[model samples]
Target: MTATGTTLVIGATGTTGSRTAARLMAGGHRVKAASRRATSIPGAEPVLFDWYDPATHAAALDGVDRVYLIPPVGESDPAVVMLPFLHRARTAGVQRAVLLSSSAIPEGGPAVGTVHQALPDLFQQWAVLRPSWFMQNFTDTHAHALSIREDGIIWTATDSGRVGFVDAEDIAAVAVHALTDEHAPNTDLVLTGPEALSYDDVATILTEVTGRPVVHRKLSYEQLRDRLTALVPVEFAAILAGLDRAIAEGAEDRLTDTVQRLIGRPARTLRALCEREMR
Candidate 1:
């Protein structure tokens, strides 16, 4: 893609999208940062874009050849709301797409997976990033971080389940490569960190890094669902709980070298990520 062609970043204020936008800007590529509220990034053009609103889609896709897709959050079935916009993007001459999907959600599965499966058919140059559970979940203002800060606890239903939790920064680096490189990986890249770790390991890492008594509190699926329902819809809460259940069943117990292979460096370790974020 030409350096002059604008790369539209959906959910530009989000974890991976924001970092990808920054990386693109640093590389001297044109970036259009799109979100619901027009938030500005230093070297990006901010555009208002909403999934439910088709009017916002054309304006966001205008003069754009590449896009970083961040699926709608908190929605059980995001494809229903996003596919139309993606079609619009293609119609508007967008040639490349990089979708941010989860490790647990396989291609053709519900949610982002549906979009992942559809991308190859929609665009000639496309890549799907299926990253493991994000390390930011424990450091940012997410539920895990909030619980750790407020009560010194990391609660989850994935008892003793180990995951190759990846850093959002690494994910973004790979995403930038996918978006700009001439020979982008035309297949889904399952990204993970250097090691597989459980929540207990994460708690220990947190305690050591922050010098605080952080503990992992494992809850039953029912209890976890109940706790999440207060914050999200019951259906979404159940889906979250179901993911925990899948983890407990050893679904996420694996690691991959995709990040290192693609980015020419090893993936970041959880300890390293915690040490950096804690400071």
Candidate 2:
């Protein structure tokens, strides 16, 4: 199906949102890059938007029918803030939506999961992109990246549990497809890289690529929660630690073809991402 009309890309300055906005613009679709700040993207319109502020919602949704939903960060329950805007969007004739959710958060589970459950009922053309841990976590804003850079250690509570880490770029590609395709996926897409690897395997890859001694420091759930508590709310820290506990139970060990099936190419591998970041 052919794509038409302007697409509002919320969190357009973010990792995946930026890429998706660029791809849509390159494909000849008009894009409105929405963020809390009026961050400009060349060749796309920029608008000030924040989920917590309903006043900013209308102008950003103006003249836009399709939206890429990136939930507000650090909020334990994003649905509370985003649902009202979504209701407004639907009422304003917005037809398609692609939400960036997480693999660990199933529909009706937690966090963005509540929004995932509501998307299908709100819009006939909607997709929830449930991606595994981002490969960029080792090079981006995440704490793991900081530890790797400073102490050459990757700390986690997953022990030997394996995860099919996906790249943010791959997730963006899938999001583009979901947003622009003639018909939306109308369901949740589990996105992951080609292979599953433990934190130890990731450290090994970092060692090989960076020519440094990188190691994985396995911590118990309690230890992990303690480490995170200083940075986030206790409840939120516990939620994050719970994901690691799920990981320990082998929750993220599986792989999926959703990326390749949707984008017609294999997802980027951990080695490739490491090599690129190292250089």
Candidate 3:
């Protein structure tokens, strides 16, 4: 990114993307906040963008050199939409791209990981952010919070798997650095918090913060599948449950120093995150 080049954030309304947009503006960099609604963000430019709608792609990419790419939510597959968008962004003269990927999804595997495999060759400079479970999944999102508030029990198949949940703010800070730095990192970063904790640990923290009884109850895969099917399609529900099973197998149970390495501070602790949001 140059001093005068534009930085486009694809999911500007989302938790991490919004923070990334704000950080870019604070650094005196040009930013374009793009979302489906064209919502304006403070200290940045606004533009309409939608992953499902290809027609809005060009206008959003107009005069943009750097991009923060976010895969659309709840769509198990994203390569179909991302591939074309990458080609179009190259044509529109995008020089770098910072993709928000997942820790659970391996590079060149399922979901957005497939998109990660193809991004390097499409742009001049690119970086992939593969952060572990987001801390916002509990506090900022309605689904997890509602479950804790209404049910008094958090249900998942992960019995004792630990996760180093990374704060969205930390993720955003790294993104800002990647987008505006003289040279892009051009590597796949696996980010995590300073400490790893299980869901039971999270429940204990919630119970302490909220002064309410919240229990982490392990559910069988079939039970979780049935519960999710009521809210989403069966296949999608299976995918969600499969993630829990993966976690149970110790898939995302490690801590990483990428956050501190990139942003000069240790990743936010889960206890701090819970106290800030749940309390």
Candidate 4:
């Protein structure tokens, strides 16, 4: 249904959240841009929200009829905090809920999967966005981007395997349809770009688009996990490293038509994104 009340966007400044919120505002949809610092957004109300703090939950829920959930980053068990907030939102009259989840994590798998499993029961009008690895990982915030800029290298355990690295914008577009369409799509969407490419292919594209030398450096799963442990918890590190290994085993070597079907446009490719960002 066409949305009537304000939609609460958690992690409003994050990769997909910011884009989703901006799209909502562009469509004249009311939005509460919820972030820890209550950061100002162009056309949405700012509200302070912290997953670890229950006090921020109630006020953020005020007058919110819809919610876009982005679980606490790096937390393996987000259901502990997520479930409680979802229950509160249900009581506060949130009719639709859209959750951002990973393509690798199924409804009942590990990590945010716990929250994915509980979302359907909490809101009858709900959808889970399971997008593949983001194309921005090479152009933005990720360590690989920093490495490419500084050392001309990209490290990963995923050797030679291809993935349909999708753009964050495509994920957000699908999310908007799920959130405000005439009828809620009560299903999980596996979003991906038009084709799969290996990191070697990515390095080639980067070199061509940016005129910079970029190389893919493959590491063993254990080595990558140990390297990541220096930056994140060992358990979470293992999970991240394991994902790379899974990719290497061809787990992510696939494409999906969800973006085209929902957004009515082909998903953006990594090369296209790189060319735009580099310019």
Question: Which candidate has the highest lDDT of all?
Answer: 2
- True-structure RMSD for candidate 4: 0.9
Q: Is candidate 1 or candidate 3 better by lDDT?
A: 1
Candidate 3 runs further than 4 Å off: 1-4
Candidate 1 Cα RMSD (Å): 1.1
lDDT of each: 0.92, 0.93, 0.88, 0.92
State every prediction's TM-score relative to the real structure. Answer: 0.98, 0.98, 0.96, 0.98
lDDT of 1 by residue, 1-279 (tens): 335478999999998999899988998999999999979889899999998888888888989998999988889999898888889889999999999999999999977888898999999999999999999999997999999999999999999999999999999999999999987678999999999999999999999999999999999999999999999999899999999988999999999999999889999998999889886
The regions of model 4 sitting more than 4 angstroms off are 1-3
lDDT for each residue of candidate 4 in 1-279, tens digit (9 for 90 to 100): 375578899999999999999999888899999999999998999999999999999999999999999999888888998899999999999999999999989999998998899988889999999999999888887888889999999999999999999999998888888889978899999999999999999999999998989999999999999999998888899999999999999999999999998878899988899988975
Report the C-alpha lDDT of model 3 over 1-279, residue by residue, as the tens digit. Answer: 447489999999898899999888888888889999999888878999999999999999999998999998777789998899999999999999999998988889888989999988887688999999888888876567778878878888998988888999999998987888888888889989898889999999888888998899899888998999988878779988999998899999888889898889888987888888777
Error of 2 at 139 (Å): 1.2
Q: 96 in model 4: Cα distance from truth in Å? A: 0.6
Runs in model 2 lying further than 4 Å from the true structure = none
Show how many residue pairs clash in every candidate, following the order shown. 0, 1, 0, 1
Worst window of 10 by summed lDDT in candidate 4: 1-10
- Cα-lDDT of candidate 2: 0.93
